[model samples]
Target: MNERDILIVGGGIFGAAVAYELARHGLGERVLVLERLQPAAGATSRAAALLTMVRDDPGQIALARQTFRTMAELEQELGEDIGRRTVGALHAAPASHLAVLQARAEVAAAHGIASTWLDKAEALARAPWLAPESFDHAVFFPDECYVEPYLFATALLRAAIARGVRCEASEVKRVVVDTGRVWGVELADGRRRAASVIVNAAGAWANRLSVDLGLPLPMAPVRSQYWISEPAPIFPRDGAIVLLPAIRAYARPEVGALLFGIRERQPAVADARTLPADLAGFVFDPDDADGWANLAEGADELAPCFPALNTLGIAHYLTGPSNYTPDRQLVVGAAPMIAGLYVASGCNGSGISFAGGVGRLIGELIRGAAPFVDPQPSAPGRRGAFDPYAPDFLAACAAARAGKTSG
Candidate 1:
């Protein structure tokens, strides 16, 4: 049996971020990261990489601001281009979310997060890709940007490894619990590894891991799909990530092409045991081609304000799943039923934006240190026993089935 001070499962953004934090704190020698597949193969790889500083909540916005600051420094320190492009972001306000947007901008400004209300003409001047009459107002977060998610994941892991963090390609099928504490992990190869503390950064499989430990979790998966427009030299070169308020879509340029996607209005779930065999190197089928076609139409509908994005080509498309909580917050903190186990999953769709700060906070909590931010209400054990047939679970399952079409 191999022994480690801390064992982290799942090598996606969550695990990679935690490993980086442990290394940054000079604890890398005691850390172990076990991945069933290559790193960034899960939701991390498909993240839109939007760095929005103005969150719907005050605390989360602050946390995001801190994390973005840290990411900027890390990119510089590593001398790697993790694509931390601070091109800014625009939140179009439909009648439904106008007040919410106004309130959020105020909260962000009070905290020194660069945000302002932009009139239609000024906003359109900056991002000539939106429809002129699409939004009554735009809340611009100048500090919010985007990052190349795969690069961010790999760069963080590289830095951690350079600091002596150990990583292995092994599937952790079971968690060993004893006396109400996490004792170790059991791998599919029948190898048992012991750890003083266990961190379940296991993305979509988090709830299943909780059940295996006799501590059912309230988190489930939500499916969000995206598509990349074909290469076009005429697309807008410099503009904030544009959002269409009424249509629930956002579009940005990627490698001389445009990427667009729709946010799922509802949540979804699927059996964790049936995860795709290959996390990386997956492709989209022709039968599902129409699924992302409408995203472009939505983008075109908002084209008057963003003239540069009025017409574009289709480059490629992909699908990713996000872990959702009952309150639509994140699931963080120690497992109430398991004393030595902690989880930092269920970021909904904002995991990439929240990864850096979340890992640091969760790492501190696991080591009994004071957390940087007050943990939200979506704690892993906030909901009692899990029921697969419950209303929430059923909704998640249905969405998951509908989301199966992917790249």
Candidate 2:
């Protein structure tokens, strides 16, 4: 048996970030990361990687701020450009959502984040691609940023490795638990690696691993699809990220093209256990015509804002599964029923934005240090032992994905 102080499962953004944070806190030599495949080969690589911070929830807003600050400092600290782009974000909604938008802006202000409200005319002036009179009000977060998620995650892993953190390419077959305490993990090769603590940051596959310990986590995997349009003359390469929450649609610049996605009224749920053992070849669902129609409807709503989308040619379609909790927040913190076990999953589609903060908080919990943000809302057992595979839980996860706000 190979022994270690801490073992983290999954090497997606959350896992990479947690590993980096543990190493940063001087646990480098004692930490180990087990990745089924290469890092970020799953949803992390497929994420749109938007980092908009203006949110209605105070807890999420604080974490967003912390993640933004941490990501800002990482380049200097690690001496690597993680492809962080401060392109800002423009969120627009109809007249009915004016109050909600105002409250969100207020939350941003309270967090010392810059948020400027723009009327239809001013909004159009800033973004000429917007259709005339398409939205009544809008708010722009100038400090909001994004990154290439895979690159960013890899950068964190690289820095952690520099500090002596070890990463192995191995699939965890099952967790080895004894008397309500996790002591190690059984790998696919029938090898046992001992660890005093285990962090489950497995993203969509989280519930499967937790089930091994009889921990019924309320997290499910739902498919999220997006389209990347070929470079059009009307699209701006450096334009602010555009979000139309009223229609559940968003778009951002991808290189010289436009990357856009829509939240279907009925989100598609996937059984994580049945998914490809290696997610490297995952692709968009061709039979999901309803999803494409939803995107068309969203484009129609934005015709007044982005007229070019009406005639754009989609260059590629990308689809990946993301984990969601019943309440659509991250699940982080120690497991109440099990000793030496922690969870950092159920990102609800904000894994990239929340990675730094979540990783830091998980590190704090493991080290018995005071956390910068409260962990109650994100407690792993907060909802108390529910069947994650139950019909109702799955339905709730789909609904949560459709209406996900912090993405």
Candidate 3:
């Protein structure tokens, strides 16, 4: 019986951050992290790693602020570079979507985030590969950057481990509950462990662990895929991330090559129960069969952004589950009736962006400290009626992705 004060399941960005924050609050020696696979090896590794902080949601803006600050602090404390590239992000929108852009700028202003509107010539100067004629408006967020998500999560875990938090490679089959409160977790081998508090930060596969709970998170898994181009000088390594809302596309510099992804009309939705422990075991394209059709669908829209987009040598095609809720907000808070049980999943495809804040909020809740930001908007019970695996509910979640043009 390994008794601990805090036990966190899943060692992705969220879990790692939670463990690190708990250690920072003087709960290091008493914390335990159980990661079935490797830390950040799950969906966290496949994250797009975009840190576009000027978001439409003010809460997200506030949370993103903490994440940006925490990244720098981790680099300083750990004495290692997290590989953060401050190339900034350019949101290029058409006339019809100008209102949305303006609204986001206003929100950024209120949150003290720097946002500046750039003329077509200036925007083109930032991303020469992008087609200036395709967009009617553009805004630049100089603080934005694309980082290596794996490095970020592992650095947090390393710091937490240095503070005496123990982690083991073991899967948690279920959480132990008695007297309507969580006590510990039951492993696959029928072994039980004791912990005073348990936080579920299990990324895309989180629903599998929470379905039996009285209050399961109202979210489902959706496939988020992206492609990388072979090295090409046409793709500048120093260029800013280009976001085209009109065509539903985003591109960033990837080591002298171009990396990009375009949202599909109906993104693939999967039941977390059917997903494999290793994300590589899952297949994303059943309809397209060979996968070329899906590739072509996205390429057509992004073709105008780069002249060689269609002809470029595609070096890699990466895909992973990005959990989503209908409202497009994170699900991070304590379980409704399961005392001492907290969930920090439901990233809505922004897990990497929100991991720091999620960890901080969970730490605050468990320690009874005042939260840095309000967490009610993303509470579990706010919209919990939908069955995550149901067809209609999955459709709703996929619809959210289809309509999402920005971040």
Candidate 4:
């Protein structure tokens, strides 16, 4: 059996970032990452990679700030550009949501993050393509940024590997536990790897792995889809990330085009356990007329801010599954009734912006050090009697994905 001090399942951004943090904190060669496929092949690759720091949730806001700072400095440390784009971000809302937007701006200011309120004319000046009256008010964070998700994740993993962390392209068949302690993991090829601690950052498949060990996690997988418009003169190459909370839609610049997504009123939930082992054959739902309809309506709402969206042709469409928790926060911390086991999953659509902080916090927890932020709200064990597979739980998750508050 191969022995490791810490074993992390999944090679998405969260797992890669954790490995980097562990190495940064002196764990070095003691860490091993087991990836079913290449890094960022899952939800991470499909993420919009928006790095907006202003959020309604304080915990998420804190995490986003930390992640942004960490990622800002990572390019220098790794000697590679993670594609950090400091194009700024604008969050706009209708009159009914003005209070919420204003409150979030205040929170951002309190955290020392610069944010300024803009009227319709000012917002139109900043983003001339916006429809003049799409939003009643808007808040712009000038220092907000984004990164290429796959590139950033791979860069982190490569940095970790350079610092002595090992990554294996192997599938974790199951986690081995005995006497209430994690032993390690059994690979699909009948090989066993021993480790004292295991971190399940398995993305959408996290709950499935937990259930296999009789420790079901409170998380569900929901489909997230986005569309990319063809290069159009109306879309600026350096446009700011524009968010319309009222419509549950967001748009950012992508290779001279506009990349956008809308949260469906009724999200499609998937059974992670039944997913095919080889994801190469997986096909996204191309006939999602309802999803497109929602996006069309969202475009109509955003047309006042971005008139070009109403006329632009969609060049491509991408879809993938993202995990969500009941309360819309990530599940990070030790698992209940399981010694030497930890989890950092259920990103709730903010994994890219939360990766650095989540990785650092999980590493600190493993090392018995103080976390930068309180982990109680996001603790995996906090959801007592929370059935992840229950209808209500799924509904709550759906609501969260749609940018609504639910528990």
Candidate 5:
């Protein structure tokens, strides 16, 4: 029997970030991470990796801002470039939705996140790619940035490994709970491991693990689609991520091309216990080039401001599961009904943006330190059921709440 102080299931951004934070807080040698597949080979690798404070929910905005600071600190301490692009992001709102964006900007500014309103001409001036007629108004988030999700995940994993945290390629079949407290985990091979604490950061498989433990969880998996443009110079060389409120699409300048992806609401399930898992139905791998060619068609519709991307080249296309919640906010903190059990999943598609903050909060919870972000919206009990919300998560919590009921 392998004994450990803490056991972490899953090695995605959430798990890696938590492990890194735990090691930094002095639990490195005593923590064990279990990953059935290679690191970052799960939903974490498919993250859109955009970071912005333009959210309607106060809790999410706070968490995103705090995560931004965490990324800054990690960059300074590790001296490793996480591929952080500091170009500010522009959020364009359709004429009918201008009020919503304006109100969101005010909420963001109140949280110490600076934002400025840009007229259509100003937005076009900054992004000459726009087709010259895309929006009624825009909000410029000067501090918004983007990081390569996979690279960041690897950085956190490396940091954790350096601190003596051990990780193994093994699947966790079940969580062991006795007398309303978590004992540890049970593997598929009839092996049982004991730990003082169990952190379920399993991403899309979170709900299944909780169910195996006989605990209720309000998390589910929602498939999202994204496509990479073939190397092209038509995209902006240097600019912030461009998001259009009217269209559920975004484009960001990467190493040699533009990366575009959007969230779609679809219920999906797959074998959670499998290694090197295949996400067939849950992932929308379009068949023909035109399948993904039309992905950004909304750009021409809503973001006519950036005309450069209207005719970009077709690049490789991929899709993956993005764990979500009824409120679209993450499910963090200790399980209300299961003692000694904690969760850091249900991050939707924004796991990369919130990974740092999630790790810090989990570290605080484990070490009995004061948390910097409030853990209410992300609480497991925030919703009574697993309901799909919006792709723009922050603004969807209220609607998610309206559909909640006591479990």
Candidate 6:
């Protein structure tokens, strides 16, 4: 077996980010990334890619602020365009969330993120499509932006590879463990590679490898689906990303179309073992099997804010599994039962937004450098032993996604 310094088992945003951070710290030659599929081909490919800076947690806010700085440095070093759209974001909710929005706006200002509370007329002026009186309160962040997730993830991996980090198209079925530590990894082809450190960034299939090590991560694959409206004159090419937590929905402009996501009353959850290598073939909705049913379910709450919902042409549907923890935080840090095994899963539907931060944290932790953000809240072993593939655990994870207040 070939000895390695670090072996990351997934090529999605988390794994790619970790590799880039390690390479940035001058450990590229010793790192290797193994992907079952192409980079960003899983959940990363389907992410909404919202970069919301204002959050409930101070740790998350700090992490999010670092994301912008990290991405800016990466782009300059790699000369890659991440397709950033800086139209900003608007949070329109009922009066019930006014104080919460006000508090969050204060948090944003403290972080040097400019935000303003918009009156009804101003809200409609910015988002002419919004129903003027649908929402009682609206907060606008003028500097918020988003990116093309695939390009963002792949750019990070490409930068890492360019800096001597190696990547291969291979699937790691399980980590080779002995003496209470990870020795290496065994691939599906029965090939083994030695690694001093193994980071399980396998995303939806992360738990599959961990469960075999007698350490099932407290996370599950939950379906996150969204619909795109067909191109129309009403939908501007650069409309601001809209957040409506009152009705549990959000929308952004998708090239002259409105791309919206609705949090179903009971979001879909899946057994990680049953997931296909290609998520495109998976069916997320089990009810009427209509992804549009989610829109209908939230129509009552959404219609007031978005009257265009009734007239918009449904264009496309994107569905995939996002690793979700009950607390809706990234599962980072080393696994307690297995030494030298780091875990970074549980994106909670914000992988794109949090990729850079996760990468930096994983890299810092592995390099013995102090982390930019405190890692206590996201420790992987914080939750007790439980089968991630089990139904009750899956429900808990699904509940987290359903109850998520942030993007």
Q: lDDT per prediction? A: 0.72, 0.82, 0.85, 0.81, 0.71, 0.84
The Cα RMSD of model 5 versus the native structure comes to 5.0
lDDT of 2 by residue, 256-337 (tens): 7888787777887876777775765653354754356656656665565567776777788777888887787789989987
Query: For model 5, which pairs clash?
Result: 129-306, 129-307, 129-308, 130-305, 130-306, 130-307, 131-307
> What is the alpha-carbon lDDT of model 4 when measured against the actual structure?
0.81
lDDT of 4 by residue, 1-407 (tens): 34467999999999998999999888968999999888889889888888877776778777888787678668888777888889888887779988878787788888888988887777766566667667788888899877899998998888899889999899998889989998889999999988899999998888877876667777788777788888876667778888777777788888888887777767777667766655545543446633576576566555665677767878887777788776777899888888999998988878898999898889999999988889989888776654567777777777777764210
For candidate 6, write residues 1-407 as lDDT tens digits.
Answer: 35456999999989999999999889899899999889889888888888888788788887777778878987798776777788888988878878877887888888788998888887767677888777889999987888889888888988999888999999897899999988999999999889989999999988888887878788888888888878887677778888887777888888988888888889889889999899776786667465767777778877777788887778788888998898877788878877889998888888877878888888888888888888988988787776677788889989988887666
Off by over 4 Å in 3: 1-3, 289-291, 384-386
- Model 2 lDDT vs. the true structure? 0.82
Q: How does model 2 score by TM-score? A: 0.94
Collision count of model 3: 0
True lDDT of residue 263, candidate 1 = 48
TM per candidate: 0.88, 0.94, 0.96, 0.93, 0.86, 0.96
Candidate 3 Cα lDDT to native: 0.85
Quote the positional error of residue 367 for candidate 6 in Å.
0.6
Candidate 4 segments exceeding 4 Å error: 1-3, 119-121, 277-305, 404-407
Model 2 off-target regions past 4 Å?
Answer: 1-3, 119-121, 281-286, 289-305
**Residue-level lDDT tens digits of model 5 in 76-151:** 8789898788788887766887776777678877887778888777776656555555567788888888888888
**CA displacement after TM-score superposition, residue 22 of candidate 2 (Å):** 0.8
Ten contiguous residues minimizing lDDT sum, candidate 3: 284-293
For candidate 1, lDDT tens digit of each residue in 32-145?
A: 999998888888888888777666666566557666866876777797788778777777766776876777677777878777788888887666655666678788878778
Residue 196 local lDDT, model 2:
90
Clashes of each: 17, 4, 0, 4, 7, 0
Clashing pairs in 3: none
